[model samples]
Target: MNRNDRAIVALVTLGHAMVHTYELSIPIFVSVWLASPAFSADAATLGVVATVGYGLFGLGALPGGVLADTVGSKRLIVGCLLGMAGSFALLSVASSVWVVAVALCLWGIAASVYHPSGLSLISRGVEARGSAFAYHGMAGNVGIALGPLAATLLLLVLDWRGVALVLTLPAVLGAVLALRFDVDERAAVADGGTETDGGEEAGDSKADAVSSWPEFVAGSKRLFAGGFVVIFAIVVCSGLYYRGVLTFLPEILGDFPSLQPVEFGGRSLEPGRYVYAGMLMVGVVGQYVGGRLTDRVQPSRVLPFAFGLLGLLALAFVPLSSVGLLPVLALCGVLGVALFVVQPLYQAAVAEHTPAGTRGLSYGYTYLGVFGVGALGGTLAGGLLTYADVGVLFVVLAGIGLAGALASFVLGRRA
Candidate 1:
C-alpha cells in the first residue's frame, strides 16, 4: 500500500480504538460505581447487567459483519461511533437501575459494530495485515488501559454521570475524524483482482474481492474444518482467560486489605486502579512484540511461548497477592502484557486459513469465540469468586491457559 492509504487505515484504526475504550470504560466504571453508596444496585445485579451487555456485544457481531459487507465498513464504523457517543450521553443521565440497564444495552449494540467493521477494514485496506493488525490491537490496548484510569481519576471529583459526559467527547471527535476519511469499502476490495499467492501481492489482490454472505458462510465452514478448529479452540480459551483476569482483577485487589495501598514517592495511594491501568498499558507493548514475532516465528511456536507466560502469571496471581503490593502490581502488568499476545497470532492464523473474500466473516466467526463464548468469562469468574476462593479462580484460569498452550502445540504440529 502507498503511504496515503496506510495513513488513512491508521486513522480509522485509531478512531475505532477510541470508541472501544469508551465502550469498555462503562463496565469498569459501573463495577466501581455500583460498589459505591450513590448506586442502589447490588454487585450481583450489576454483574447481571454486565453479562447482558457482553452477550449483546457478542451477538451483535454477526449483524455488524453482514452490515459491513452490505452497506460499508466505513459507514458502520462511523454510525457505531455516533451511536456509542449517544449511548454514553444517555448513560450519563441515568438515575435508576432500569435506565442504566437500557443505556448499557444500547452501548452493547453500538460496541458490537466495531470489531467486524474495523478489523475488516484493516484486512482489506492495508498492505501488511499482520503489522497493521498489530498496530490496530495496540490502539485497542491503549484504549483499554486509558479508559479505566481516566474514569478512576474522574471519580475523584466528578460523579459517574460527569465521568460519562467527559468520556463522550472523544467518541464524538472519533466520529468526526471517521467521517473525514473517505474509506470506500467496496472500492477497497475492487482495487485488487483475485489471485491466491501467499505473499503481499496476493494479500492486496484478495482484499479487492468482496464475498457474498453465502460465499462467506461456505468459506467459514471450510475454516472450521481441518486444523482451523484447533486454532479456534485456542482462541476461545485465550479469550476466556483474558476476560476472566481483566473482569476480576480490580475486585480481587479491592478485597485484599494489605495490598490495597502502595507507597509511591513517599505517598501512599490506593493502587488497584493504577495496577489495572498499568496492566493494559503493558498489553500495548505485548501487541507490538507479538506482531513482530508473528512475522518471524510460526504462530504455533510463538503462541505456546506467550500462553505459557500467561499460565505462569495466572498461577502467580494468588501467591503474589500475599507478597505485598509491588509483586502484585508486577504480576498484573506481566499478565496484562502476555494476555493480549494471542490476538495477533490468532488473527494472523485465521487470515492464513481463510479465503480473502470471506476474511470479514472469518473474523466475525472468530469474534463469536472471542466475544460470544468469551463473554462467559465474566459470569464464570464472578461465580468462581463468589462461591470458591479467589485462589480457585486463579487456578481455574491457569488451567485454561495451560489448555490453550497444549492446543497451540497440537495446532503447530498439524500446521
Candidate 2:
C-alpha cells in the first residue's frame, strides 16, 4: 500500500483504540463506584454487571464482522465510536442497577464493533499485514494501559458520573475524525486483486470476493483441524489465565494494607494501583518486542517461553508479599509483559492461516475464543476469590499458563 493508505490505517486504528479504551474503563471503575453510598449494588452484583458487558462484547463480534464486510469497516467504526460515547453519557445519568446494566450492555455492543472492523481495515489496507497488525495491536495495548490510569486520576476529583462525562469527549472526537477520514474499501481490494487467465465473469468475480455467513462458518470449521486447533486452545488458556488475574488485581491488592496506600510526594496514593498500571504500561514494550521477535523466530518458540516465564513469575507473587514494593512491581511488570506479548503473534497466526476472503470472519472467530469463551476467567476468578486466598488464584492462573505453553509446544511440533 501507499504511504497515504498506511497513515490512514494508523490514524483510524488509534481512534478505534481510544474509543475501546473508554468502554473498557467502565468495568475497571465499576467496582470502585459500586462501593460508594450513591450506588446500592453489592460487589458480586457489580461483578455480574461487568461480566454481562464482556459476554455481550463476545456475542456481538460475528454480527460486527458481517456489518463491516457488507457495509464498510470505516462506517461501522465511526458508528461504534459515537454509539459508545452515547452509552457512556447514559451510564453517567443512570440511577438504578437496571439502568447501569442496560448502559453497560450498550457499551458492550459498541466495543464489539471495533476489532472486526479495525483489523479488517488493517488487513485490507496494508501490504505487510503482520507489521500493520502489530502496530494496531500496540495501539490497543496503549489504550488498555492508559484507560485505568486515566479513570483513577479523574476519580480523584470528580464523582463517578463526572468521570464518565469527562471520558465521553474522546470517543465523540474520535467519531468526528473517523467520519471526516475517507477509507475506500473497494479500492483497497482492487489494488490487491489478481486477474484469472480464464477471464471470469464480473458476477462470478464479485461473488468470489464477498464472503457470507455460511462461508465464514466453513472457514471456522477448517481452523479447528491441524495446528490451528492447538493455537486456538493455547489462546483460550492464555485469555483465561490473563484476564482472571488482571481483572481482580485491585481487589486482591486491597487485602494487603502495606501495599494499599502510603503518603508519597505529599499526597496519598494507592501504591498497588500505580504498580498495576506500571505493569500494564510495560506491556507495550513487551508486545512490540514480542512482535519484532516473532517476525524473526517462530511463534511457537516465543509463545511457550513467554508462558513459561509467566508461570514462574506468577508463583513469585505468592512469596513476594514481604519483599519491598519495588521488587513486587518489577515481578508484576515482567509477568504483565510476558502475558500480553503473545497477542499479536496469535492474531498474525490466525491471519496467516485463513484465506483473504474469509479474514474478517476468521478474526471474529478468533475473538470468540479470546473474548467470548475466554471471558469466563473473570467469573471463575471472582468465585475462587469469594472462598480461597489470592495465592490460590495465582496458582490457578499459573496452571492455565502452563497448559497454554504445552499447547503451543505441541502446535509448534505439528507445524
lDDT of each: 0.73, 0.70
Summarize candidate 2's per-residue lDDT along 1-415 as a digit string, tens digits: 4674676566656665785477447645765654668677655566667677776776677677766666767888888888888888998898778888898889878878777777766655555555666667677777876877788778677877888888888888887877777555533344234322111121221243336667556656765764667777877887677667776776666556458767766665666666666677777777777667656766777778878887887788878866676677778778768877888778766655544555566567666667666777777777677667678988988888788889888877875
Q: What's the C-alpha lDDT at position 265 in model 2?
A: 66
* C-alpha RMSD between model 2 and the true structure: 3.9
Off by over 4 Å in 2: 40-42, 184-213, 263-268
Clashing pairs in 1: 189-208
The total of clashing pairs for model 2 equals 0
Candidate 1: worst-modelled 10 consecutive residues by lDDT: 194-203
Task: Assess candidate 2 and give its TM-score to the true structure.
Answer: 0.89
Q: Estimate each model's TM-score.
A: 0.89, 0.89
| Candidate 1 local lDDT, 1-415, one digit each (tens) | 5664576566756765786587557656756665777677655566666667776776787677656655667788778888888888998998777778788788878878778777767766666667777788888888988888888778667878899999889888888877777653533344464322233333443443345667556656666876778887987898688767776576677666654666666654556766777788888988888777777877887888788888888888888788776787777777877887888888777766655565666667777777767777777777776677789988988898898999999988988
Candidate 1 stretches greater than 4 Å from native: 38-42, 184-197, 200-217, 261-269
Q: How well does candidate 1 match the true structure in TM-score terms? A: 0.89
Clashes of each: 1, 0
Worst 10 residues of 2 by lDDT: 196-205
- Output the number of the lDDT-best candidate: 1
